[model samples]
Target chain A: MSTIEDVTREFEQIIPSDTAAGQSVQERIIQMLEELRFEDRDVFGIRLAMEEALVNAIKHGNQMDPTKTVRIACQIGQQRVRIEIEDQGSGFHPEDLPDPTADENLERPCGRGIMLMRAFMTSITFNPTGNCVVMTKDRSEPEPETPAGESA
Target chain B: MSQGNRRLDLEEVNGVTVARFTDKKILDESNIQIIGNQLFSLVDDDHRQKVVLDFTNVEYLSSAALGKLITMDKKVKAAGAKLRLCSIRSDIKEVFKITRLDKLFNIFDNRDKALEGF
Candidate 1:
């Protein structure tokens, strides 16, 4: 029998609604993901999801006003990782966003971020106010055992 | 790579203008604006009839950056020029695939391959 190792880590950062700050936040998240030994594809998923959320919070939610702030929190556990991003602006309904992949909408660029986040993360939800979004991705379960003297 | 202005390094190969994005993280608002303007300028220039964006050095691009690409693609087509992309990382490719922009643009594995289309 094998047991799952348990680890819990939490990080919080409050950054002004400046686009420059996004790079630092991305680096921090990448470091954390690397420490957990996540695979390149998983790291890319997390990075892309986080980038989408942070940019939305700063550019749309905060309107890139330096006076406003975006709050981001991350919790990583053995089974899963969760991230929350909240912005200080009037939130819009997520469902109202048009489908970027649609025939007529394919030329549009702004709606794709939400679609990418939905495609990468295991789950994505928004607060009632729509000002905050929570994203989660489950860790990969241990691989099934291979037969003796056989490669996986 | 020396920047022609701030965020992009431009060079002409044969008859195509290859504008390579230099930033590893292209999430900044200002950087997006600068890049978009530069690409639009290339689309408007008569000498630059063929434009290829080399994403060899770009690690990440925000939705705004993708939007700029779409806008540039449209402009390039309207101006009777060509817009091609080369050396896009898999992660970014996933974004393009999800948005179905992969079907909208001509993407090649390398600069030479992209140039061949022109």
Candidate 2:
């Protein structure tokens, strides 16, 4: 298996606060993941996480202002990938986000993006102002099933 | 509707409306808005009593897409109609689970199962 030392490819781009531009950036990262032989499930998670983060930056962070822009940086290794996304806007506190999983909020249309990002990424952190987010995902192998009698 | 404007392939199966998403990725805001409108029209305009969302063709969906589904659910309930989802990819299913939306929506393994009592 490859290690962090195998990290090679990197990408950096500044795009308008438009989802089309965000999608292009996502495709480049996903293409790199595929080239590195990342597992399909891992690719799925990473793609989903990137989608959430980019949308948050483009739509929520920049409020889809054409004048605003989003900066994305990515580093891909054989074993892991890291991404940083920063938007031009007044940041909000990540901690203030309502728990989408909570009973009262489950049916709400928004507020689930951050939760999905945390679930799919190995690690996710936000800058103090919360306009910038950094997320990392280490390629993972699926866990083996517990034996019938030994199930926890 | 023009091909570009139609996001769902609607089929009526035994009085139930089976709406299949045509896009492989439902991520963009404009696309989600169009989809949400088409979906809402099922209840608001067409008055579908039983609706089944077939996701077999959807390989990717963003939180905005999920938001549309939640709003659709609300509309269905408001109209006293039924709503169910089927054929979601496993990874996408995990998205629902993480959001605890699996508990809120009636999800099935396939269209047959999703349509079973409806």
Candidate 3:
């Protein structure tokens, strides 16, 4: 695995408060990850986490205000790859989010961001401003032990 | 979405309705919501049991789109139908792999391979 010191790449992009903007940010993130020598898996998680972050920022934070801005910053370091997404809106507390896996809300379309973030990233945190999210994914780890003939 | 070409192709088999979406990478909540509606209208109870989504032209996908898939799957399964996929490209496959969605959905190498058991 290439350590952060081996290749530390950075990316910064600002997109309009629109869905298409999210795609551009995702593409930029993948390009930056590639420059850091990350393959598909790393890029996938980062893209997923970052997309959720941006969506929440645009939809929830800024309330889809076209005039507002969503800022994204990424840094690849030795320990992990970190991404921060900030919105100009009043932020919501990460702790306050309801669980999407709950039976009562299983059918809901919205509320899965936190779940996916936790499931895919090493850590998902929020800043005090309530409008910023910091998500991290550790460098790839060895595969989990799988019994012979057992599918992971 | 652009109507630039075909993003989805519709088929009905054994009373199941299938709409294969291709080359879709950056779909949002609005378009996905619309697709959801279109999917509901396309698949009737008679054809719900054997629907397939072909990703032959798709190379990448977003988690939001994945959310849409799960929601769609639930609806299809409720109607006693199944939603399966085939011909998923490698780049998009990695998204499914990393997100552990590979285990959540039935994926095949090609359209014929996916529709074989059904």
Candidate 4:
């Protein structure tokens, strides 16, 4: 059986604080996941979580400053994918964010991105300074095989 | 609107306006801004009483897109107009569910259902 270190592929890059730049990085990571034959559902969740995290890094953390940069590190394996995103700006407290799901905040336009990142990722963490976030998603188990005669 | 500039395909069905999203991935900020403006115009400019946002062609969207939808819903409600969302893929639907937006907006499985009672 392959361990995390045995099967994992590691990558790292630093990108400009531009949405387009972030998108290119996202596309690269997605292609890697597809190449590994990750399930569609897992891919979908990871893609969503990554988008939110990168947007937060580029737009919110770095404040879209052209001079600032976002660093991304990723590890992809047969059993899981892990990503770490860090920005140049000072981080804010995650607890201070208003709950988008609350009745009073439902109509609010923002604040849902972080919630979504947590929901889609199997595990999510923010550095104490709040400038970086790390997320991971475990590969879903395949559906059990049925007997040849069963309709299923 | 210029053909290339259009982000939604608007059709009037029995006095209800159905606007289908043209893009498959509504993730980018500029694109979401354009879509939001078009959606708000349905009420602010056209003054349409009943609107349905059809998502059959949309396969992926981000929180920025959701923010636009929330703003659209507010405009629709403030104008005393009604808005409904339909044909959202399961993955996208889960996003709404996670944000508790499924309860905020009137959602249906298809356009026909969304247009009902309009």
Query: Which model scores highest in TM-score?
Result: 4
Q: After superposition, how far is residue A63 of candidate 1 from its true place, in Å?
A: 2.3
The segments of candidate 3 whose C-alpha lies over 4 angstroms from its true place after superposition are: A1-7, A141-152, B1-5, B12-15, B24-26, B30-34, B44-49, B55-60, B70-118
Return whichever of 2 and 4 wins on lDDT. Answer: 2
Best by lDDT: 2
Provide the RMSD of all predictions against the true structure, rounded to 1 decimal. Answer: 5.0, 4.1, 5.6, 3.1
Model 2 stretches with alpha carbons more than 4 Å out: A1-4, A142-152
The iRMS of the candidates, in order, is 1.4, 0.7, 3.8, 0.6
The candidate that wins on DockQ is: 4
Residue A54 in model 4: lDDT: 90
Q: Write the per-residue lDDT of candidate 1 for residues A1-152, one digit (tens) a residue.
A: 11224546788899999767876887887798789877667777888888888889998999999899999888877677788899998998999988788899988757888888898888889988889999988776555668899963
Count residue pairs with overlapping backbones in model 3. Answer: 7
- In model 1, residue pairs whose N, Cα or C atoms come closer than 3 Å (at least 3 residues apart or on different chains), thus clashing, are none
Candidate numbers, best lDDT first, in rank order: 2, 4, 1, 3
* Clash totals for all candidate models: 0, 0, 7, 0
- List, residue by residue over B1-118, the lDDT tens digit for candidate 1: 1225666778888877888888887767777887787778776754478888999998888778899999998898888888899999888898888888899999999988998848
Q: Ten residues in a row with the worst lDDT in model 4 chain B?
A: B1-10
